[model samples]
Target: MNDLGRIEDLPADYVEEMRKVNLVPLWPSLRGVLPPLKPKPQTRATMWAYADIKPLLLKAGELTPIEKAERRVLVLANPGHGLDKMQASPAMYLGMQLLLPGEWAPSHRHTPNAVRMIVEGEGAYTTVDGEKCPMSRGDLILTPTGLWHEHGHDGTDAVVWLDVLDLPLVYYMEASYHINGERQPIKPDRGDRAYAGGGMVPTPIFERSHKAYPMLRYPWDEARSALLRLGQDRQDLDCIQITYVNPETGNDAENILGFYALMLRPGQTLRLPARSPSCVFHVIEGGADVKIDEQSFALTEADTCCSPGYTPVTLHNRHADKPTFVFMADESPLHRKLGVYEVRN
Candidate 1:
């Protein structure tokens, strides 16, 4: 129709003139009546905050070798809730994970991105792809995009960690796969300790890894003592949100993944910087009212929350006399790589 209409004369009916031709790239123009191309309504998917929140507790006796600590996971954006499945996007899949003493989550691997923030525990380690990193409370471990990994609690104290994966993101894409290795968990050999950290030497960068950081572990202890020390001064450096960095260069570990810890002192409320990459956080220690887009929601240890990539989010320590801590993860780095990650600020 566009061609015929554009021409001075047509030999056949307007509809008949178009029937013999195949659709082209500009199909919308076929009708000859310009259908104005409007930007898809600027919509940020639905955000599930407070109200219908239910946090489950994974109890001790119920755990098996495959799981420990009476594993409890609170589903936030799930297909069951009249919402899209969590695996559709990389920013989703926020689960609170806990493991009791003597329990182990044996070896396994998958195609989705995953990370764990030690909520509480003394000795537990997640061997990623093949590298083993010691798991201590507040530690951050990265299982970038498609690495295989497993968790084991070898310490005398119970171990708890929040497992945040791109499950919902993968679910949406339907690009998910998993493999279970033998149940045995072993420390990485000295030469193969790349997953834990040896800097760039351990990172697999074969072009494909471009825009994707594969380092698997980000420990919280590294930031813990420093936070405590800074707490003494309690000045401008308050609420240090140190992005999980490449241990060797001291540069923000430019992995496709990102993780951080927030230290909240009593009465202190941290206003999350605008353009936060759709943060996913698990309460590691203490409880507080986390304000997202100005709405306050109470969160305690083991509870998880998800914020859209570009929105206002805040963390306020409600505990009058205690310090509250949390671990946050996001795929903003990856999005930045794709040239699609942006903040409103």
Candidate 2:
């Protein structure tokens, strides 16, 4: 602590210079922006995001048993692409995964909070804290950091989902972990037979205090429908534009991070206002003229556009009206973590 004293600012004189430049006069000067609105910038992140999984997955699927099992895998992120394989964000990484059926990722759990949202498929089970959660389309399942969890699909089908965590957050916090989980002989608990089809509410339980995600699944159907409706109305600047919100609060899920689905309505040139946050868009169904920082790129179904945050972003609907819808996610969380988030206007 003694060695660090010199690093602290000298206060009055350091800020008093603001007057010399006339940036702020007297009354509304240094004191006005006191204490800083957010935390100090921790570090610059090594930006690594890309979208070219189909070809990779296809080639792998042909040889491996994933396809034979009627399952598929598309790695949304991984260290090979700059995303730490085990950690999500620097501060959080419940663990990243893409699983299909007739295969088991093995039983394992560690002290890293994690969760999964079923992107596609049905009848997959994720046992957490000894409580087996059967996953279905739109279902959200949690494997609290170190709680024992295993995945398996005995049904006549396969499943897929998006995984999120404090991985990046964890790595940033410098609390990353690695573990080899034990293989359990059987399913831990099958007590909640009622909540078989996902949606946590329908399931019965004994002790509810030690909790998990309040809901089993955050449905993308309603969200998708809403965007579709907005597209149908030919509203303002939407090929399809809508933001992700936390269901309980009805506010943006996380101030630093947000999501929007854009569906273009044929020949629709959706103009995206320049944003302070970098955005990544995954083409769900259609195409566009994804332009960023003045360079143009074509984005088709299953393609992706990852723009550097605060970098100018613009889009033009090239397809003649069939409608182009995409799912957008961003590092507003990262920006907030850095404490420099704001809008010029």
Query: Which candidate number maximizes TM-score?
Result: 1
Q: Residue 302 deviation, candidate 1, in Å?
A: 3.5
Whole-structure CA lDDT of model 1: 0.60
TM-score, one value per model: 0.66, 0.58
The local lDDT score (0 to 100) that residue 168 gets in candidate 2 is 62
Give lDDT tens digits, candidate 1, residues 95-152: 5455556666766677777777766658777776556778877677777665566677
Q: Which TM-score value belongs to model 1?
A: 0.66
lDDT of each: 0.60, 0.53
Cα error, candidate 1, residue 284 (Å):
2.2
Model 2 regions more than 4 Å off: 1-52, 58-98, 107-150, 154-166, 178-212, 232-234, 237-240, 251-256
Clashes of 1: 26
State in Å the error of residue 62, model 2: 7.0
